[model samples]
Structures are given as structure tokens and as C-alpha cells.
Target: MNGMKIQITAELLDGLVLAILKQDDYYGYALTQRVQSVIDISESTMYPVLRRLKKNGDLTTYDQPFQGRNRRYYQLTAAGEQRLQEILRLWEQYKDNLDQIFYQRGEQQ
Candidate 1:
């Protein structure tokens, strides 16, 4: 089966990251892996997003000892959760609008 490749916008990335963190905290590498399971994204691409979210106060990070090294884990802050909800709402509306147009066109075929 083939899939249509779509661009992952900043809002989409931010929403996905927040949703993942809502389930549980994750380190940079682990978060990238989780996201990769669903969409294709490079490590370099993910790092800047994580940094921006943290800088925006939407996410918080803590270092934990693991395998004799400190791994930074990202958790969703209250603001992050709120932002996720807002993004989700907007995404739903956008998807609905597109679906209406696409589904109507498909039905005409």
C-alpha cells in the first residue's frame, strides 16, 4: 500500500509532542522515536521543535540518571496541555472542512 506524504507543520508537531508527553515524559531520542512511529521526521528537525516548545514555556525538562548518564526528559506543562487542546480543536475544524470538500468531490465520481 502507498501513502500520501504530507508536510508536518509546526503546529502539528507541537500538538503531537504535547499529546505524547501527556501520556508520559520522554527524552529527546525517545520522543523522536515515538513520533517516527507515525510520521517521518529527522532528529535535527525534532530538536528545534522541542527547544522551541520549552522556550515558549509549553514544556518543561528534567534530567534523570540513566545508564550512568543524565537524560533530559520533557514533560508537558499546564500551558502545554492547554495549547494541545486548542490545537486539537483547530485541527478538527480544519480536517472537517477539508473532508467536506474532498468527500463531496469523491461522491460526485
Candidate 2:
């Protein structure tokens, strides 16, 4: 499992970004760090996801001054919240199906 590569799809990436933004707004670097903490992803991979979400109208951005520089912050829109809900619903269904298979196998053996 240590060396196994789990592919993170774009949909999952979008959901993760939206979910993080659902809690509170975050600057680009901070958001990347948060997502990276959960899974192995590069900053290069993260920026495109952010761009896509923003293009899809699921996210909005603003700039705030920090340390004499403006840091761009991302916030979830109403649409983003809706997207997150849908993703959560789908994820639950997928998890449940996998759980059934795993647990049922355990019970059979």
C-alpha cells in the first residue's frame, strides 16, 4: 500500500477543494497545503483544479493584503455548496457499495 498509487480523479479533486472552501476561504498556497496534507499531490496539480473550479463557477476569488503583498483567497459559491452536497451523496453510495463487498467477503470466510 505504501508504494501503491491511488489515482485521484478530477471530480474528487473538485469536491475536495469545494469542501475545504465550504469551511472558510483560503489562499491558494494554504488550500494546496490543506489538500496535500490529506493526499499526496503537488502544487502543480492543485492550481489546475482550482482554475477548473473557478471556471465552472463553483468558486470565487478575492485578494487580501498580507505581509505587504496581496494574497488571493478562494471562497465557495452557492453553486460550489450544491456541488459538494452532490459529491458527498455520491461518495457515500460508493463507500457503502465497497463496504458491502468487503464486509460480506469477511462474513463468508
Candidate 3:
């Protein structure tokens, strides 16, 4: 059986994309694929989230030609980058708290 995977909540996914864009600009399909590799999710499901992020002023997109086709790519705005960092910090703190809870409760069966 696969080990218990960390649940990638919707909010977490928003944060994840911003964090990834920090590394490099990526098209929607590429982002969907990359995110799915880490957590099982569909491209269709990803689009709305991306759209919402864009609407919220956290993402900016552009098109680039690659060989024969133009791909639409997304990048984190300064606001998005700052938001990602803040979310990461909070996640880390929450994780520490959860770890303490788990340890206090003892290992699962």
C-alpha cells in the first residue's frame, strides 16, 4: 500500500503553484503535470484554481513560442511570492504543532 500522503488542500495547492513559479515560469499543462506527480489531481481541476489566482492578482501570464507552438506561461507576481513565503512559514509552524500532537498520541496502527 502507498504510504499516507500529505493531503494537498485547495489552499495548499494555491501556495504550491506560487512556490513552483518561484523556480521558473511554466505553462498551465506543465504546472498541472508537475503538481499531479506530487499529488494526484486533474488538469481540469487545476484550471479553475489558476484562474482564481489570476483573478486575485497573484499570477501573471504570458505566451512564448517554443519550436512550433506558443505556450501560455504563468509567473508569480511579487505579491504571490510574498504570499507563498508567508504560507510556507505558517505551514511549517502548523506541521510542528501537528507533529507534537501525533507524538503525544503515540504511533498509529
TM for every model, in the order presented, reads: 0.92, 0.91, 0.85
lDDT of each: 0.94, 0.91, 0.88
Model 2, residue pairs in steric clash? none
Q: Which lDDT tens digits does candidate 3 get at residues 1-109?
A: 2688766787789988888889999999999998887787888999999999889888999999999999999989998988898889989987888887877754656
Ranking by TM-score: 1, 2, 3
Poorest 10 consecutive residues of model 2 by lDDT?
Answer: 100-109
Name the better of 1 and 2 by lDDT: 1
Residue 52 shift from truth in candidate 2, angstroms = 0.7
Give per-residue CA lDDT, model 1, range 44-71, as digits (tens): 9999999999999999999999999999
RMSD of 1: 2.6
- Candidate 3 TM-score, true structure as reference: 0.85
